[model samples]
Target: MKVNKDLTATASANLILDELYTNTGSSSFNLEHDFFYGGAELEIWTMANQAGILLTEDTDYTLSDIDDTLTNQASRNVYKAVTIDNVTYQSDDIYFSYQACADFVDADDRYMVTREDGQYWDLNSSGGFDLVVSDDITFKDQYLASAIPLSESGTTGLEGF
Candidate 1:
């Protein structure tokens, strides 16, 4: 008889390793982070040295949760698709770098709060968002890194990496 076991770890790891190398010539990886930086800002390397060409989003690999701008990213996914040449096999190691809310106590990481209609709040003494509420962001989209592609023009989000 087989006995099922309850998971001691219920949530996904803040920093996880997903091995993409395979003998079947294809692989898929899942990244479930609430504050995932998103695909447009994500940088994925298919090689160990990270010196060769970078894979293009939607063309080489498909990133899930492309619809809404909601805060919940538990449904997000990243799939390294199969190519004509089986691109995944070219390298024995795959690397990726991204920012996410890994920890809540770390001040370097941003915080999330609940919002509802008919609610109001004011910025804290430092002009930062309040834990209870926040005013509508009046800053231009160009000034926001999350809204704009921080990479150089004509580059496919692979500039710094």
Candidate 2:
């Protein structure tokens, strides 16, 4: 999936990484910290007043419900489809950044979608199997040093390690 850099709408730039890496660069030259700050925030809302409507009467619900809510809120415009292994999957949970919802309207295919940072996987599919999202989805976060230790040599650069 591509994270769009266009702040005009909600879709922000999405990048894929085969492995995770830690930033050991200087505080002013840290690429990871800059990368995380570049990420956009997504906001989701209901189209109809039935925003509280639950997909299922039972406590248990399928991913379909989430997919439906998104698509329905988006009205199928911004995020028309989600494909996995060339197979398109539909969901009610559609996501777009905060800016994307500015002019958003709710219609048949209109629904709200939110961007989340972390791993998301589709535990089940119509093919009678679960599809791991690890291979298909990419997550981004604001990179920052977990902790910045103080420097003894008066080198402030080593303090925020």
Winning model by TM-score: 1
Span of ten consecutive residues with least summed lDDT in model 1: 1-10
* Per-model CA lDDT versus the true structure: 0.35, 0.24
Model 1 agreement with the true structure over 1-161: per-residue lDDT tens digits: 11111122122333333324433334443343323444544555665444455666656555443323223343443222222134553344545554343221222222222133533333232333344323322222222112223345522221111
Model 2, 106-140: lDDT tens digits are 12211121114443322122311133222222322
lDDT of candidate 1 at residue 140, scale 0 to 100: 24
The TM-score values for the models, in the order shown, are 0.32, 0.16
Query: For this target, which candidate reaches the highest lDDT against the unseen true structure?
Result: 1
Candidate 2, residue 97: the lDDT equals 20
For each candidate in turn, give its C-alpha RMSD to the true structure in angstroms. Answer: 17.9, 19.8
